[model samples]
Structures are given as structure tokens and as C-alpha cells.
Target: MEQLLYITIGGSTHTATMVSNAATEALLTRLKSSPVTVTLNSSGGFEIWGALGFSLPATDEPVNAQPGDIVLYNGSNICMFYGTNSWSYTRLGKIDGLSESELRTFLKAGESNVKVTLSLSNTAGLQSVDGSVAKSNGSAYTLSGTSACAGQKGVCIKNKKKIIR
Candidate 1:
């Protein structure tokens, strides 16, 4: 089955169809445990790049990255393009259903320290009460979509029901 990567920035989520590669496989495996949030900065007016804080297996090859293209650089950094660049990178995935202008806005072009979260959607179509993709372990999520423990106060979703704790 094809896997989807959900990239959330500024509360707006975009989906990407993951490419079949070792780098992507490693990323999915890491995301299975929890979502990874990276602080990215705009570079060269073309892409938002950052260190993933973890390294992935890379099979670097010449790539002409275009808008919406996500790639891994130097085995540890992640780059999301909003303009264009030619570089050797490990292909990760490409965002879908967004135009160039939309990509710029969604990626916060020209911004610094933009927070981007990467998560995976399960094949079962299970979602948190807030309609965000559920964690791989099916844990309850808070209204903002982060994993919530029983001790957390405020509204949370578990098994598709809203529960106030």
C-alpha cells in the first residue's frame, strides 16, 4: 500500500505521496513512534531547510528539486522546496494539490525558524477525535492533535469520542 506523509505548518496540513526509497522508509519508521517537528529556515529564496536532528539512510543522486519537493540532504537535513534548485539529494516525497503560490504560503517562504511537523497516516483510516491522523499506537490526542495523556486537562479525543479530562 502507498503511504502518505502529512506535513503540518501553521495548523494547515498538506499531504505528500512518499517515494519508495530507503530514506523514505527510514523516515516512516521513525515517525511510527511519534511525529517529528523541525524548525526550518528559508534559504536562497527557494527552499526551507533544516536539520532533522536525526540521520536517515541516503542514496544521493542528482535531482532538480521543484516546488513542493521534499528531499534529504547530507543524510541529516531535510529540505522542502518552494522555488527551484539543482542538487544531489535523496528523494523523499512531493506535496500534492498545491500551486506554487500556495506552496510559498504553506511553507512560509522567506521566514525563519518555521515549525513543520511530519506524521504518517495509518492504513486503517483511524483518526483522532479532532480529525487529525491518529498515532500509530492509537493513542488519544488533544484538541491541537498532540498525544494527550489521561492527566491532561481540557478536551481530548479517544475512539472517536470527545472526553474532557
Candidate 2:
């Protein structure tokens, strides 16, 4: 099943969905525990990090990504963008109904760092993952120790692929 992820940053909440795959499965499973909070900052045209220490499928990498695209970067980072990027990114979902300028305003809420809360939403859609079908739900988690990763640009892997959150 395709599920929605609610990202609350500052005063705005954006919704996104995941592409069906084992990687996405692993991520959804972690989400059931609680919503994951990650410290994020603006970089280039996107807000990167809030690394949930969650891993997912590095499946499809779109040649280019537009605003409101939620993507898995480097297999560990969940990146939401307000601008365009070209890379092999496993697309999680896109934020619906936000105009381009509105998205930029949301992402650029601040220049330093901002905290984002991610939780599974009530809406769902039909999708496939590893040839299996099951219903899944989620909310948020802790971001108590990832302040160190907040100021940096791009996803930084620690201890050989660990996000160190």
C-alpha cells in the first residue's frame, strides 16, 4: 500500500508518499515505532538530512527532480527539494498542492537549521513492494542527538554508512 508521510517543519506540514520496494518497506517498518525527527538545513535548492538513521531502497533514480520531490539520497538521506536536481534518487513521493514559490518559502524558513517532524498520515494508495501487499502506518521518532549533522551540507555517513543519529 502507498502511504503518506507528514513532515512538520516550523509551521508548515507537507505530505509525501513512498515508492514501493523493500527499501521503502524497511523505512515504513521503522516509522511504525514513532515519527523520526531530524535536524535539517537548507542547501542549494533542497532541505537535506533529518536523517532518520533509516535505510530504504535505492531503486529508481530519476534523471531530474523537480520541486516538492522527496528522495532518498546515498541510500540513507531523505532529501526534500524546492529546486531542480539531477541524480539517481529513489523517489519517495512528492508534496502535493504547494506551488513552486510556496515550497521555496517552506524550505527556506530559515538559513541556519530547522527541525522537522515526520509521521505517517491517514491517506493511502495502491502500490507494490517486493511482490507483496500489506497495510502500514507510522508517526515520528527522536532527534535528540543529531544536532551535529544539522549544520553540514549533504548527507554525512559515519562508522561506515551509519548516520550516527
Candidate 3:
């Protein structure tokens, strides 16, 4: 595919954790109840690609279900071979970072169906009982929508529990 289908975080820093958690919840809500999965990959690092995928709801239902898109985080195996560790190697580049213009575009496009998922190497982004970005809105800030999440409409799957904030 031309895009990456996964979201991966490399560090346990505060900013990284917040973004990682928010991104994952935002993406999962966009998935529209699709089956979720995770895997481990050992990349060599010749390439790194990021993409946002979308799928519309099969039926028109008001349940906060809309056509949304997902922002995928990716890295190449080639980078893993470099001196850098997995965290630095997998962290997205300028093109995939929050500052990229595509961030908004991806969210807007995926507002209907794409559920965002994030894979973190550390616990930086874990949320409390209340839905809030643990860290300040640094490079990114997400707009709220129709999902169970109040600030945002997507559901968050953390610690293996499905919670919609």
C-alpha cells in the first residue's frame, strides 16, 4: 500500500505519551467498531511512510458513527539497523509529525470512519479516568466529535479495556 497502517511511538516522554494515547483513542473511534489488532515488527529502515486510511459507515446510524480516517504511524526495518534505537527510529518524520498540514486533513477526512490506533514503547500517554491530554497541547490539538469521548468522539483502548472518553 502507499500508506502505513500503524501508529508507533518510540519514547516514554510526557509529550510522546500524551500524543500516543490521544492518537490511539481518536483512531479507534474512527475505526467504526472494526476488529483491532497489534503486531511487532523488526524493521531494517530503508523506508518510512505514513498514511491515513478511511472507511465509511455501512448504514446511516446516529450512534456517533461517521465516516472517518486513520493516521498510520510507520517506520522501515532499515532504520532499526542504524545506531538509533527503536523509539527514535520509529518516531515519524516531519511529514508525519503533528505540525504537518496533513494532520488536520487526515482528521477531517477520517472524521467519518477511520479509527486511530497508537503503539507506544512506554506509558507516557496513558489517560486518567477523565478524558484529557496528560500533557499540554504541544504540536497537536484534536477537535471533539460525536464519539463517546467528550473532548473527542473516539473510544480509547488502554490496558486492554475499552473506554470512551
Candidate 4:
């Protein structure tokens, strides 16, 4: 629920300036400050996005991700970087409770519902998982993924409480 902005990237373009730019853009947006030299702590790897692969916009008129290159969100961890778009929300921490099976089912269901909510609703802005989850305390649990949500590592949660009821 606490929405924090962090940079995320893959191994494919570590050396590429574009990768740096993407990170820069994310940081700038998240940090909302003038650009400056920044040091990043990262675990290296390569991943691609989109059906074709690449997530970078084409330099030419064709604005789409190229094949083999994965699309990246500005603030997510890698892997399921973008549940739908190049951006997603993420949170991380030591899970305090909930059995493994319960956690699994919660995440699976939450991910599915989140995707549907995202697609159907105009949720273009970043939302506080911690804030929302906090409100639903005891109703939800976290599912952690090594991958990025826009490029940051953290926990994903499955809320057990039924809001619909």
C-alpha cells in the first residue's frame, strides 16, 4: 500500500543509454526533482516485454516495443513487470502471517482481480497498496516476487477479505 518509486531494468540493456534513460525517467517522475548524478544498487539480468519482446518505443514512426526486447515499467521489479501496462504497483516486506497455500491462492486471485480492475477501471495513477491494504488489514496477505513492478523488487499481496460482499 505504501507506494514507493524505484528504478527497474534487465540484463539486456545494462550498457545501453536507453536503459539508463528509462531509469532516469522513472526516478525523475517518482522523485520529482531536477536531474542529477545518481548511484543505483541493482541485481543484474535481462528481460523483455510485449508479445514481440522489446518495450522501448521505436525510433521511427512505428511506436512499439521491438522483438526480443522486453517492455519495462518505470518503478517495478522485473518478471511480471507490467501486469498489463509497462507500469505496475509493488510492495515488499517480511510476511508476518498466513500459510504458504493461503498466500498462493490469495495472490493468484488478487492478481486476476487486480488485472480486471485495472483494465476496466481508469486506474492510471499509482495507488497506495499499503494504504489500501492497511484499510483491509486482516483481509489481505502479501505475495512476494523477485520481479519488478515497473522495476522494483517487493511483495505482491492477495487480499482474503471480500470487498464485494
Q: Which candidate is the best by TM-score?
A: 1
TM-score of 4: 0.18
Which runs of model 3 end up more than 4 angstroms from their true locations?
1-30, 47-95, 98-126, 129-165
Misplaced by over 4 Å in model 1 are 122-165
- Give the Cα-based TM-score of candidate 3 against the true structure: 0.21
Worst 10 residues of 2 by lDDT: 133-142
Q: Look at candidate 4 and tell me the lDDT of residue 54.
A: 20
TM-scores, in order shown?
0.75, 0.65, 0.21, 0.18
Write down the lDDT of every candidate, Cα atoms only.
0.84, 0.61, 0.28, 0.26
- Residue-level lDDT of model 2, residues 39-144, one tens digit each, is 7777764555456576666785554888888888878887788877888878777877788888877666336566777777421121222112211221111122
Counted clashes in each candidate structure: 0, 9, 31, 32
lDDT of 1 at 118: 90
Per-residue error for 76 in candidate 1, Å, reads: 0.3
Candidate No. with top lDDT: 1
RMSD of 3: 16.1
Model 4 Cα lDDT, one tens digit per residue, 15-75: 1122334443443353344212222221122222112122322222222322122223323
Q: Which stretches of candidate 2 lie over 4 Å from their true place?
A: 60-62, 122-165
When summed lDDT is taken over every stretch of 10 residues in candidate 4, the lowest stretch is 8-17
How does residue 151 of candidate 4 score in lDDT? Answer: 28
